[model samples]
Target chain A: MENVATGEAQRAAELPMDNDAFAGFYERSARPLRAYLARVSGDAALADDLMQESYVRFLCAARSWDGEVAGRRYLFRIATNLLKDHWRRARSPSIEEIPEELFATSPDAARIESQFLLGPALAAMRPRDRQLLWLAYAEGYSHREIADVTGLASASIRLLLFRARRKIARLLREPEAEGRQGRAR
Target chain B: MIPKSCPRQSEVAAQVLRGQWPAGCVEDLRQHVNGCRACGELVLVMLAFQSARAQAVSGPAPVSAGVLWWRAQLRRRNAAVERIARPILGAQIFALVVTIAIAAILLVAQARNVPRWFSWLTQPGQSPGLHFEDLWSSALAMPVWGLMLLVFGLAAVAVLGGFVLFSDRPRQ
Candidate 1:
């Protein structure tokens, strides 16, 4: 592991460190990456930290990537692994326990409503399901891109995404159905 | 328009999200979404989820690129320092242990000689005829090479100690 880290560091040293190029990359990807981390982990602070780490690690990665899209996908992969490491090292809070600023801060009424409807529903689902759904819907990543970021089989994404969508729809509807039933009573 | 299950549901949804649906198919896709309850619900939820994620991430990043670059540089420098220091640290520790062991052996030998030397000194009228030449020829006399070794060992230990102490000091 140490050797691998060292070798990666050497490779990073050899990679371009042009400030202009890096700044451009950061400007393009930082916000989306932060949002992805925040949505997946449901922690803004952790997202912020992981955002920086992902960029740093991306710049320091041993392998070279071809284009911006590939680089961005690789960055997401690094962020996912970092999140997994965080989970392995420490017990993470459930989605419901995530701070409100992560999902509830938007001033737009429609956005707020969507977040209100989706946040808890997302929190209620497994992390992997949330990841798959978010990558599919939110990030607009295709099955292959999702597979790349998630380390999942590309063949399985469609089925998994379909299942996840159904689950989220059920979760979103359950409260309304209960409320209607209560009103009738 | 509302089939029970379209095989192209996932593909259509993905294309809609990407804003890449063909112009000719947009009307048909819209009709299908409006007519099909399951597809409509999926599209609605997916769009809502996408909007919510966009809003959630719309905030500015906490730190800028320059700061991140500075941190990366700092990390790289620290790693480089550690790489250089590791072997030196190992060597210093090894030298320390050997010096301590040699010093300990010398102390024990000197301790055994102390009582005999003291007894010899306290003996009355026993060394009146003993001269400086006799003392120089005595078995207790330290050889030139031995004296040089002791001096060199002490100096080496002191220099190494100082080097270790100075190098281990915390940097600002």
Candidate 2:
């Protein structure tokens, strides 16, 4: 298969859908999809690139958007596949990036502070761990849906998710423990 | 953070995701989440994820939706062009190969039996110039026919291959 740039780099003017209709879909799906890619791939820029390409592929896909929920799932599945393909084709592994710049953009101080902690823990965990947690709690996708998006078997999601939660819990505890020591000192 | 999970933790998370937490949920579940260590941690993490999602959703999209849609349209068009071009290119190559093969067979058969001084125009007198009548002649053995066919085939391939190579060259 060709890379993400194979098509996006080319000029296309074949309008397959109404402009306003696509705009609505893009507005609803873009940010959340970016967030999902950023956290899972640990590269915010790649997430952004991948997000744009995913929509392009999504629109180009032959399937119907009959079910709105199904459309969202299909979008995620496309993004996930693209991300995996990027990782597979890359000469070196992608570096983990939390996009600390984004934290300042958020007006909610409390949420930002919590995310500061969670981001690293997510970054420190394996790619699949971040994927499972983000999809499960962040997107609220069920185990079966997670299976569909990640291309993992449904039966293994629970055990894998359970292990992922435990790992994050351990990672989260360390900084808190350090903070407690610093406070006591 | 707790490594263990409360039985209702997933349930509480589901409620939170559905945006039905605390108010929509039964009072007992709220009390339990507050009291259970695992559930409390779960709540904190889930809320953080929710807030992060909110921030991302509210943030500006990297590219405008209109541009994205256009690019998607363009990409689809490009792919369609590629899909159509692929078979046409394949058929062109197949026809070229078949033409060369037929040319080679005819050339080789003519070469094997005909004398070094053969002419396309039939001679006015003497033995007919290498006509089909020569097929049973002593000079034209079966192996000679096969050899001639081989030579003719090679000539055809060379001629066709050269034509293809020259035709494919880019114009200055």
Number of the top TM-score candidate? 1
Off by over 4 Å in 1: A1-16, A42-46, A56-67, A82-124, A151-156, A169-185, B1-14, B21-42, B53-62, B107-112, B115-152, B155-159, B168-172
True contacts kept of 2: 0.57
With candidate 1 superimposed using the best TM-score fit, by how many Å does residue B168's alpha carbon deviate from the native?
4.9
Per residue, candidate 2 scores C-alpha lDDT tens digits across B1-172 of: 3346577877888888888876899999999987987777667667767877887788775789888777877678777656644654675577578776777666665665566345434553454445657635634555666656666667766766765664475522
Please write out the lDDT profile of model 2 over residues A42-159, one tens digit for every residue: 6677888999889888888876566667788889999989977886676434423423233222234334445476765665566767788999888989989999998999988887
Model 2: CA > 4 A from native: A1-18, A90-115, A169-174, A177-185, B1-7, B23-26, B108-172
At residue B25, candidate 1 shows an lDDT of: 55
Interface RMSD, all candidates in order, equals 6.0, 6.6
Candidate 2 docking quality: incorrect, acceptable, medium or high? acceptable
The C-alpha RMSD of each candidate to the native structure, in angstroms, is 6.6, 8.3
Which lDDT value does model 2 have at A11?
Answer: 38
lDDT per residue as tens, model 1, B77-145? 556556755776787787788788767766765676666566657874565325666666664466565
